[model samples]
Target: MKRTLVFGDIHGGLKALIQLLEKIDYSKNDRFIFLGDYVDGWSESKQLIDFLIELSQKQECIFIKGNHDAWCQEWLENDVVNDIWFLHGGKSTIESYKGIDSSHKEKHLEFFNEMKDYFVDENNNLFIHAGFSSMHGPEKEHYKTNYSWDRTLWEMALTMDERIQKDSLLYPKRLLLFNEIYIGHTPTLHYNVEIPMQGCNVWNIDTGAGFYGKLSCIDIESKEFWQSDVLQTLYPNEKGRNK
Candidate 1:
């Protein structure tokens, strides 16, 4: 049977990632998909990226760009944007490369730039970094831009109801017939009461691994879910209290 394992946000948790991979029992025939946010929050961003690069060279691996990743690439491309980049989880990412040299930094940026916006299988299983705009339903054409940083379309779609009209609608040929999509970016209900519907059909696998939640992954063909234990606390609990 053809198997594709889709991993959720890493957030620089190399140990957790390694544990999850062990559980999956990776094989030569199976394909692996990373849904982005490979850095930040945890302390192993550089190691995780290096491991991903090595894996990509050996087996089939799909990478999607996340918001944090976008910032990393921007900071690496130009030094002028350092302030803005550091504000968005770039601090931890930079710290991950403390001992590395200029050559390694260039390679890291190259890898980040090469990541794809989305990955689709023969069965039409769509894997995107972040959730798609509800305005476009699950169509591919609506996902032309990098969703990692684009919020205009998403913000508009969030306010509207969920409905795909045949007429006066933009639907991509690739997703017009697909049954499901797998994505990251938006956290699940575990983090917030009003879970964003923009991630709905997007099969959110993020699960806020680096926050007050657990890491998640799923088998596209089986719809079977797997999650790692909550790594640590990220914020105060409800009622304005700390845990």
Candidate 2:
């Protein structure tokens, strides 16, 4: 059966990604929507991006840009690394690129540059790396970076009174604008839930692979999901957020 799957933050956990695909029995018919931050945390950052570049050639994918992706793109294009980013996995990312061909790096840079900040499918489901600030919708967002940084959208949904009916005026305008909103920047594990989290119509899929949690993917239609082993187990030698 054809399935449209939404993936959460990779955080450079290439092994987890590969393992997740095998577990899902992924096939060409399976559609993938990756919420970014593909590089960082783990030791295979460059390799992970390279694999994704090749995968896109064989399958349908919607790549949403995350804040980490933005930082990686800049590093690729300008050879500059952000001090803050280095402390939070950027050092590992740069290390992964060592000895990689410059030409190969360029292709990865192009892939990052072309990623979308947000995607709306035929069903009007919204796929974004983070959240948007505009109540009018992402199209009218005051700041595009908010697509990969805003937490207000998810926060509103998370804190909404469960008692409020969807039709009630008390409902948030933003939540009413889309059939559903999917995001990844904030890991669901933050709340101590290790699975995909639902807050109203918003879904948080980042299960925290960047740290000790597992990488996750959810079937947008059926809500069935899959996860990799805790990243620490997959890369015992690496400090995938043990720091």
Candidate 3:
């Protein structure tokens, strides 16, 4: 059977991302869902985008847009970097493209423009870069950007008591709308775990590849996973967002 693999925020850690793919021995039969924030934090934002563009030609790939990606998109379109974006990780991305030609810049911008806010599979599995509004389902048609920026969904799962997992009524209906929900953005490392985390039906796979944690990928069907070494180990010269 074909496998579906999901990846968390890369934050521009090209080396780690490449290593993680190698560790998984990714095959063309695999369908990959990337949870976004592909650029920023690390120095290889440009290279990361290039890699993904190439990978998409080789396999099925789904790209979700993260807030960082939004900021990057804005910078690409208007050439005005948001102050907060610069503070967060945009500075490195800008530096990475210093002296780079415009044609490649356009390619990266186009990739960012085409990213989706979320993806729902035939099995009703929701894959997103961040949480979605629990009050409004993903199908709701207003301020759709919230699908990639909301944190309440994950926050609810993170705070939910383990004993309540089986209580259908206790869980929010929006979360129950899907068989499984995978998200990035909030790093599992903050929860003191470097591995993918499961809370209720939600899985937080952002193992903090932007910081001290590793980049993570997991098979949605088998729950098997692979992770790269620490971000510091892969990009020893760069401080990334950990600074």
TM-scores of the models, in the given order? 0.76, 0.98, 0.95
Off by over 4 Å in 3: 165-168
- Taking the tens digit of each residue's C-alpha lDDT, what string does model 2 give over 1-243? 888899999999999999999999888998999998998899999989888988899999989999998988888888888898889889999999999887887778789889998999989999999999888999999888899999999999999999999889898999999999999999888899899999999999999999999999999999999999999999998888557
Question: Please, what are the lDDT tens digits per residue for candidate 1 over residues 80-171?
Answer: 45676565556677777788888988999899989987776887667777545534443444555446644433333334445654343554
1-243 per-residue lDDT for model 3 (tens digits): 789999999999999988988899877788999999998899998888899999898899999999999998899889997999999999999988788678988998889988998899999999988876745677783667777788888888878877766556786777678899999999988889989998778999999999899999999999999999999988888899976
- Sorted by lDDT, highest first, which candidate order results? 2, 3, 1
**Residue 180 displacement (Å), model 1:** 1.2
| Model 3 lDDT, full chain set | 0.89
Relative to the true structure, candidate 1 has a C-alpha RMSD (angstroms) of: 5.3
The lDDT for every candidate, in the order shown, is 0.67, 0.92, 0.89
Candidate 2, residue 85: lDDT: 87
Candidate that scores best on lDDT: 2
Rank the candidate models, highest TM-score first.
Answer: 2, 3, 1
- Provide the lDDT at 91 for model 2: 91
Candidate 1 — worst ten consecutive residues by lDDT sum? 234-243
